[model samples]
Target: MSLASQVGAVATRTFREKLGPEILEVFDKSYKNFTDVQVLSGTHLLNNHDVVVESPTGSGKTLSFVLPLLRILQNSPEIQKNQEIGAIILSPSRELCNQIVSVIKPFGEKLNLSVETVTGGQKVEKNVKMFKNRGVNILVATPGRLFQIIQHEKTLISRCLKSVQLLIIDEADRFNEIQFEDHMREILSCIPKQRRTGLFSATQVKEDDDLVVFGLRNAKQVKCAQERNSAAPSTLKNYFTVCEAEEKTSILLEFIRQKTDKKFLLFFPACNSVRYFQKIFERCLTKRPLFAVHGKCSNSHRAAQIKGFSDSSNGVMISTDVMARGIDISDIDWVIQYDLPKHSSWFVHRAGRTARLNNCHMSRFLDKHEKVKLEEVKVPTHTSLKSEELRQKMIKIQVSDRAILEAGTRAFVSHIESYSKHDCHIICALDDLNICGLANAYALLRLPKMRELTNRKDLDQFERSSIETSEIKYLDPKLEKQRGEIMKEKHEKKVEVLAAKEKKRREKEQRKMKRFGGGRGGRGGNLKKNENLKRKRSEDEDDTENDIRLLKKIKRGKLSKKEIKNVL
Candidate 1:
């Protein structure tokens, strides 16, 4: 069949007119050309058959399923009650959820289909209110938020979704890895068993296929040539420069300056890297806006950055794995990996952001990868503790009073220090309690909790600049454990060095206490003994000098025998 004929423009028009002109308008705006995926997915969903779509990034995957679902919802008015949600779209990240919402909201409004977003980092009570208090014909959500709402308000969401004829899981491959397999299954159980399901993603391994099969019932699969999964886009020019960890940031700065005219999507392994590099860019004193998106940013904040970056003509966005999935931002001139990507799949998705929609150029700056989080599984924390509740609680209690006190001397002292090294804020504060003046012991306490270390004590500039600047990292249990073991020899070597240093320090201090009875670092007994030894040594030296002088005086017969004997 001819490619255009296979694309079936007539099929698109028929759905458009019946659905309304809004559908056709959004379709053209959203996609570059009516690709085969759209044609095939559009036709398949129109046929009321389930579908599993595997297409490359920017291949109109969103619209492929979206357009078809729109057509379905448009024609299913009789089936959907007023205020009943007709379809549910589940994406993995808040950013992706909002992106989907942006894409379909206009079309949805034009068609009188109310669209609402349900994702984490927003108030659950508010989202629950959205479902129960008002009309939401379409719900776009992340797994955790979706699962939470359903778990708590199962009846309400289920009732709203009573007319939910379609369930679309965007980026099924990533969602499958979303640390919510059980929650996903529970969510599936809550939904109508026969709702037409569409699973869309760019990368689907065997495990993904297996999980997808659970939600889909003999769904027809529509995909590009198998090569598309692993292949970079033909238009994309892939280039990489491998440098030592220290040189990565400098090289990145140079690359961004060299490509100043282009826009970019720079990817980091984690959110901290994004924030850390934002600091780097600020230090470089760039004129352009530095857009950032990561798990740490509020949902609205992240969504705003994504939109603002997308609309801006020239800007840099540094993001984490959140953007590495299926986020379509047009006119991205370059996709820079400031750090090594998580894996092969990561390289593909991170690179896919650029060379999109017949191509454009972009620029960015980023840095710092600590060892990947996976290393935490095999090795316990240096403290041999897994949970941070105590650490955080301990931190909280220590800072509680100081965090509250505004004008107190202790607070002033803590502010000067930011007191992170203090074991207990209470003890540090009390020990330093001097009515006369601020206690010198307060030096151990850092005043404000939020103060950042401006200089590196243990690491060099390059090493300290890393996002994983912390001595430790956060790791989840099954989600991370299942990924397989990490090569721990490097970390083991590091631990050994630290352990030896600690041991050596203790032994040296102990010996100081024993030898002199005590040195400045030792007990008072060691200090007193050291003083006595110095006095005795001086006396012996004086006696020897006196005896030599007395001998000289005797040779000259100029000294009394009693004085000489007294000197001896």
Candidate 2:
């Protein structure tokens, strides 16, 4: 039988035997729409076989993986044993991890399974403790923190994973980036080979096969029709305009002001650009609630901003690529590319944020240069090209030296700084050059004519001489010291404030205890000590206020005897 027919048979069996009447009723009641393609793929995954489910944003892909996984867990005797972690899901963004956990929790809970989210923005220790205590059956996390946990507290996490049978990596394409591949490798290494792996992505890149090779060796490919052709569920209209950099802000403002009802997301290339647009938006649209979220914001602040934006459908959220993945907000009518993405992948991901889950109507704005650049590049395919051929092709293409310098200088500096103190400084230097050369070896390697000194000894000697006489100034000591002092003072003040707050809180608790008739020698015996602490706090506050007032007076050149008396 064909895959579809087999999937149909599985679904029929599942409905009759596995789901029963109650679950079917709940599923029917909660689900507005269901796709057969997802059902078939999900059934395949539930059978403990590796499967890749490639569906678009809204075709019920989340439920596709989730429901079958939950059903598998429900049927398994291992779940009854109270396994610490029955399944592991890895997503690219914290928001996505949280979203997956949110979806899994209700289903898992119904089956008496616990679900927990682990991401980088939160405390690692708390998550570690949660895993140790067997509080979670399904653990969803980003790659970085997950690797860190595996590296540092492997025993604690491994127990959970040894019990884990299902591992789903959502947004596989995003996670398989060149920068994060090593971390991804490290994470996959920790998982037991016996466990089943599933890779899910909205847009599958060519690297999916490599991902399969690394872990999911026997993985079955399930390419849903959602990603083929121009069948994107959303009516995402792409448009371009030519304008000077100075006029871009005015145009953006005018465009935002023109929109009356629908909410929008404006994307920028960097955090600085996000802030710049945010300021312009704030000034232009005072009546509307405008919020910006980026990597620069504190974790708590970013979470709050994202939550607020997600909750409200009428407000605009301006952000960088930080919100590109994992952000699930319904009713984002428009997505403006204020700054075009540097890479086609980023552009895809950013655009994916909107037109989510089949809710259509997205509009993208681009400049002429951005349009030209985007047109010149092809969307990344799931095929690898020869490295040398790729290098030659890149050399043939004209890229600005400024772009190369800007990118390479940063990497070069980091490489140099990473190994300056090692005794093998010459080797380190050579390695740095080699690392940098990998980007454009044909162009860069020949520039430094030390290629003839291929012998280790000669290379080392040449490197040492080259580095020793290098004119690069590492860092200004005075500026570094000033920064250190500023940070130290800020930390000291923060500690002092925290201590004061704690003292006040304790004093308040003691007062409550005394007020409830638990006096000295009773439950409130500590009241006197707390009262003394409160007295000291009041005195400190008074002194601080007086000092502030005196400073103001001094600033105004009106310092008087009363200020002096208070200071004394």
The prediction achieving the highest lDDT against the true structure is 1
Residue 230, model 1, lDDT: 29
Candidate 1 structure lDDT: 0.59
lDDT of 1 at 6: 42
Question: What is the Å distance of residue 186 in model 2 from its true position?
Answer: 2.1
**Candidate 1 lDDT tens digits, 541-561:** 575466446445555545443
Weakest 10 consecutive residues of candidate 2 by summed lDDT: 356-365
**What's model 1's lDDT at 565?**
44
Candidates' TM-scores?
Answer: 0.59, 0.60
Candidate 2, position 43, lDDT: 63
- How many pairs of residues in model 1 come into backbone collision? 19
User: How does each model score on lDDT?
Assistant: 0.59, 0.58
Q: How many clashing pairs in candidate 2? A: 2
